[model samples]
Target: MNPLVLPLVLPGVYAPQEDTALLAGALSEEPLPPGADVLDVGTGSGALAIEAARRGTRVTAVDVSWRAVCTARMNAWMAGVPVRIRRGNLFAPVRDRSFDLILTNPPYVPAPTGSRPPRGPARAWDAGGDGRFVLDRICREAPTLLRPGGVLLMVHSALSDPGRTIEHLRGSGLKASVTRRHRIDFGPVLRGRREWLRERGLLSDADEKEELVVVRAELPV
Candidate 1:
């Protein structure tokens, strides 16, 4: 299925990129019962939320950046989708809510140690250290937000350790595995941090590409 095209991306908000497209593609193939509840965590431009909404699911999108919240709201409006956009870090805004599906293309770019947590546009992708900063939290928290038989679809770079994500989710009693992977040339962020990544043994000097994987975790009814 073709990835849904976004309507607008405001400055400081993350624009839909390869990771976004990968998650959207996975969402397209997911089984969504009519009126299923869906949550798009760290939703940057409302792309995933709008896509789910188009599929007749009830979508609520959340982001830490107010600019991102505004951008997503506008994009949803432009797409004529009713996505309830909220501003907060991760699932904080939607506490106590459960959903049949959850989608995220969170920040998984490993930043150097001692680097301050990202702000502004950088917050969209600059993850601290091993890049599991946000990913790990999601692994721990997402299961609680999923209804029985619900699924969580998350996209992150292979460098962040998909194995660990799978294990973490499984430890939480959810069945998790990598469902898709796509390799692409390192973007500006990875390219600029190539040396740092190599120092951490997460990347090789000769490697110019990074693999992005979509991890699907399902809750048994």
Candidate 2:
């Protein structure tokens, strides 16, 4: 089931979009044992966390934004699921704790700027140039957060280079690959930056859509 069908999205918090839905769908297909330990990194509105909880998994969610943390907490409360929500950057709030599953839909939109916005709604999508700012960190850190046989289900834009993510995860000793892909029309954010993206060779002149991918990485048991 989709977890964020009607989540309470605070003004500065990110609402569930395509990436969230994509990640949730992948979570639904994962073989989560009852009461499995799960982590939702960057759980903006607790969508994936709620979904995991619905499947009878114990979920702990973390986000960098306080508003997002609060939004997720409230949404999970409304969903009648028990999710431990914390405010911190990726992996910081859950140090030393490993999980059977980790879900993330982090900021992957490549932006003209080199740094993420310090605050505001833009923080949800304004990733640094090349869009590897948060993605690279997750690739490096998430593997360590996974238990033996644990799986990471992450969704990001093709513009961020899913192949690089796979390689990074594999180098970390996890078996990784793209599990799903979806083509979507450029949203307002991408459309407004079309010219800049084209100049950077990240987008083609004829390309009107962006491809989002779900990269699944699993640790060996």
Candidate 3:
């Protein structure tokens, strides 16, 4: 990964990649009211939490990996912000807490024909046997975790089937909307990283290009 790192709302940390810059920018809306509780799901490196905390929102950040939880806490301290980083899968850690804003960057990449991600945190980047597992779960559970009129913001790849996401969210009883989007070339990431796909004969010879969608859904007031 070339020792990739960048200065964020925090300092002195090496992030595994540069994609967080895109995530941070796309999640630019400061959805927290001062004194409001916020939940950051899939707190990879805690960029979203740090940014929200920088604006004075109390944050509870969660991730499946202990390493990710540690990283989020470290980033929060480095940023001179305080965040509660918890270790758990999806929303399991906060089943009892409702928030005014829930921000997530879930693995939405549907598993390609035969490919699967390497076990562990790699799945954080990979969505599923095709990438919608986490997204589907998030949409399905977001309504219950959100306060009335609260919002959920998720960044997902177009490969996750944006249409399906919208439909799923609406079916889950949330009002969904497309808030932002950017096209990302999957060529580099997918080219040399298809072993799992090849193992399952899931990958085609076709080159894959993808769109990244930043969606926001509001729970009814």
Candidate 4:
């Protein structure tokens, strides 16, 4: 797949990493109706949301970081796509709305320390301890926001347990499956946690790669 071109990335905002590309590639293959309502949770540089808008979907993007929100808004404007950008954690800003599709590349890197999510750029990737801090919430809450037949596409490291994601979505009554996977070299955060992760049995000492998986979960019509 050709790389999906992205707009400007503001400092402190998450850029379009491998996980983002994997999810975007899956999004490109989806059969979306014109004007389909789409929501992008934790939208960083607005890459996925803007791409959805390019496909004729009405897209709304939400993020917990003000910088991310601003970056997304600017990117949407630069891309000449009308995307509704809001600032809030996970699904809070869209609690009362329903969407035909949802996209997210949430924080899934296992942090070795406290339960509190760390501040700064690390917030984009550091998930407390088990790395389910954001993923679990998305699985539990996203199904509630989907319209009948709506789909949610999310990407995360295999270290975070893609099976758990599928299970959680299935438990919520959505049919879910892993749609794509890509093995890539460890990024700085993971590199820093390599030993700690190995000690926790989440990673092997010789492992230098992480598998990123894109999950597709859909509501039945």
lDDT of each: 0.90, 0.90, 0.72, 0.91
Q: Which model scores highest in lDDT?
A: 4
The CA-based lDDT of model 2 is what?
Answer: 0.90
| Model 2 lDDT tens row, 1-221 | 23247548888888888888888889889998899999999999888888899988899999999998889889999999899999998999888899999999999999887874545787788789998889999999999989999999999999999999999999999999999998888889999999999999999999999999999999999
The model with the greater lDDT, 2 or 3, is 2
Which is the better candidate, 1 or 3, if ranked by lDDT?
A: 1
Please report, as a residue range, the 10-residue window in candidate 2 with the lowest summed lDDT: 1-10
Q: Give Cα distance to truth, residue 52, candidate 4, Å.
A: 0.3
lDDT of 1 by residue, 1-221 (tens): 23456768888888888888889889889989889999999998888898899988899999999889899999889888899988998999888899999999999999885457887788889888989889999999999999999999999999999999999999999999999999988889888999989999998878899999999999999
Clash counts for the predictions, in order: 0, 0, 14, 0
* Candidate 4 residue runs with Cα over 4 Å from true position: 1-3
Poorly placed runs, candidate 2 (over 4 Å): 1-4, 116-118
Ranked by lDDT, the better of candidates 3 and 4 is 4
Any residue pairs clashing in model 2, and if so which? Answer: none
Q: Can you give the TM-score per candidate against the true fold?
A: 0.96, 0.96, 0.82, 0.97
Estimate the lDDT of model 3: 0.72
State the TM-score for model 4.
0.97
